[model samples]
Target: AQTVTQSQPEMSVQEAETVTLSCTYDTSENNYYLFWYKQPPSRQMILVIRQEAYKQQNATENRFSVNFQKAAKSFSLKISDSQLGDTAMYFCASARGNKLVFGAGTILRVKS
Candidate 1:
């Protein structure tokens, strides 16, 4: 069984600052995928970033980046220059086959 874990239940960042949300997972399968999904107050699950298990390089999209430590089974999301719009529930997910498992999620509140 693969389980995603986000130790931080809530986090807040000042506008234009940076914040990193920690995540770790336990999985037996070597081939899998990790993802970060953001759900705003509207409740839409939007994909933030993704990293394949076999890939050594971390993935980044605009102001979002990931610190993928395959050996430690850790995948963390870093948001640079955070904005009010970035405030949302960030969930860490793992996918294998057709199933996706998500963490409890961390509520990020960006203050202006």
Candidate 2:
């Protein structure tokens, strides 16, 4: 069975700073997708970024980016210049075909 693990249950970062959330996954599928999702107070699952297992380059979008280490089975999210809006529950997910597995989530608090 595929599993995603987020060792940090909660984290905090000052406004305008950067924060990196750690995530590791185990899967048997050679072709898969790793994703980082941010869920704010509204409970909306927002797609931050994603990386294809076959791709060597990391995925980035604005202040959000991912450090994907395929060989290590690790995919982490880096939030640069984190704003108050970035404070939320960040979940790392892995998808293979129709099945998806998510981490326990890391609650991020942006301190002002």
**How many backbone clashes does every candidate have?**
0, 0
**Which TM-score value belongs to model 2?**
0.97
lDDT of 1: 0.96
List model 2 lDDT by residue over 3-102, tens digit each.
Answer: 9999999999999999999999999889899999899999999988989999999999999989999989999999999899898999999996887799
Candidate 1 error regions (>4 Å):
none
In candidate 1, how many Å is residue 59 off?
0.1
Candidate 1, pairs of clashing residues: none
**TM-scores, in order shown?**
0.98, 0.97
Local distance difference test, each candidate:
0.96, 0.94
How much is 22 displaced in model 2, in angstroms? 0.4
Which residue pairs clash within candidate 2? none
Per-residue lDDT value at 66 in model 2: 90
**Best candidate per lDDT, number?**
1
- Candidate 2, superposed: residue stretches over 4 Å from native: none
Residue 97's lDDT in candidate 2 = 81
